[model samples]
Target chain A: MKIFLHRRGFIARIAALMVLPFVAQRRAFAQSEAVDSLIEKITGGAPLQRGRVKLEIPTLADNGNSVSLRVVVDSPMTPSNHVKSIHLIAPKNPRPGVASFFYGAGAGRPQISTRIRLSGSQGVIAVAVSACWDAS
Target chain B: MAARISVPQNARRGDSIEIRVAIQHPMETGYRTDDNGTSIPKNVINKLACRYNGVEVFRAEMGSGISANPYLSFFIIAANSGELRFDWVDDAGVTGSERTSIIVAG
Candidate 1:
């Protein structure tokens, strides 16, 4: 009886130790998925490139409440290949989709500078769609 | 609800426009604990859209990764005189919008 009890206690401890990290990892994975969903939704299933949009943010933000941000897209401000719009999105904020901007071909430049609040250190995304001059 | 956005009343054509917007809300993410250790319910803005003279130019969907009092900046080509509109929506079904007009130079 004594031996059985000892073995049972040992097994229980080992099982718990094995399960803890998995639980923690699962939580982290869930958070990642939540953010991914936000991005997918914003793109409306469109493909996004890593270097296409330039997102300028501080490496470490002093205040999570307000941080400065600038997003610039590589596009000519011409009627043929201008940027139609720009969007800034954060998946973990109280509001996931932060802001959107619409521009026309007549708008000469394609750059924006603004400040944003971040709940924490989270990924920021900028989406730009090229103007369809033929349609216009 | 209405969103508060501020931009220069006058901007020259072909000049880069600066836009400042301040959204009023708690921006609760539901993951944090209060002083009492209770979980806070998630409340976040999920969608944002902007328009120039009624044409859809830019759109974004957001999550809880943003902080309170969210601010955004972007540019628009100043070709013709028209209104710039900003709109955003949260996860809990709250929506807000603000608008400003720009006088373009000939």
Candidate 2:
């Protein structure tokens, strides 16, 4: 912030620098919480806890057209303990639910990589569900 | 359809290796029309999946936002010698696949 202020001491620069964080903060919060609700809706309102899901994406992407992504879930992949499905959510995109990948014990490891389109810069969320946990 | 792939020929057990795949296609968007003034029906690869030794390891779903001649890069943990297969389906209901093999050293 100091560097930004020092580089551009103009009034517009000052205003922009100040407004940027607020805007980013609001958007970030809305986008993330929206993604959380989307996951909950997909899972039928099950308890949504965050852990064991890894989503890899570029921090800054100029072109929202085609962005590469990778997601991995830490699971044992055994019948008694395994990941049944992994879903991706991009809250701000035209389609919130970008992709859904199904897996079973045969999948060995629950991981996937693919390309996605983002209308603008926003964070992505991935949720992996456990069959054992769901079965009770 | 022509597809090209690049994967590690051999890797030490538990090594995370890179895999790249590129497919050739027009990927026409419905928004564009031909010289005849008829809208060029959209035909894009909507789904792509990667399977290792008959087990699905990766999957992706693309939309019209994707560029033509789609190329994707992914990773996998090499546990043993097996075949890595890729299958894709376009909106036009066309399906294609490509296969490659990798050997892991224990």
lDDT of 2 by residue, B9-97 (tens): 99888766777888998766566667778777778888988898988877767665455687766566787798988999999899999
Model 2 DockQ class: acceptable
For each candidate, the DockQ is 0.33, 0.25
Highest DockQ: give the candidate number.
1
Model 2 lDDT, full chain set:
0.65
**Which predicted model would earn the best TM-score?**
2
Q: Give each model a TM-score.
A: 0.60, 0.64
What's the residue-level lDDT of A36 in candidate 2? 55
Regions of candidate 2 where Cα sits further than 4 Å from its true position = A1-41, A74-79, A104-111, A132-136, B12-18, B26-38, B55-57, B65-68, B73-80, B104-106
Give me the TM-scores for chain A across all models, comma-separated: 0.65, 0.69
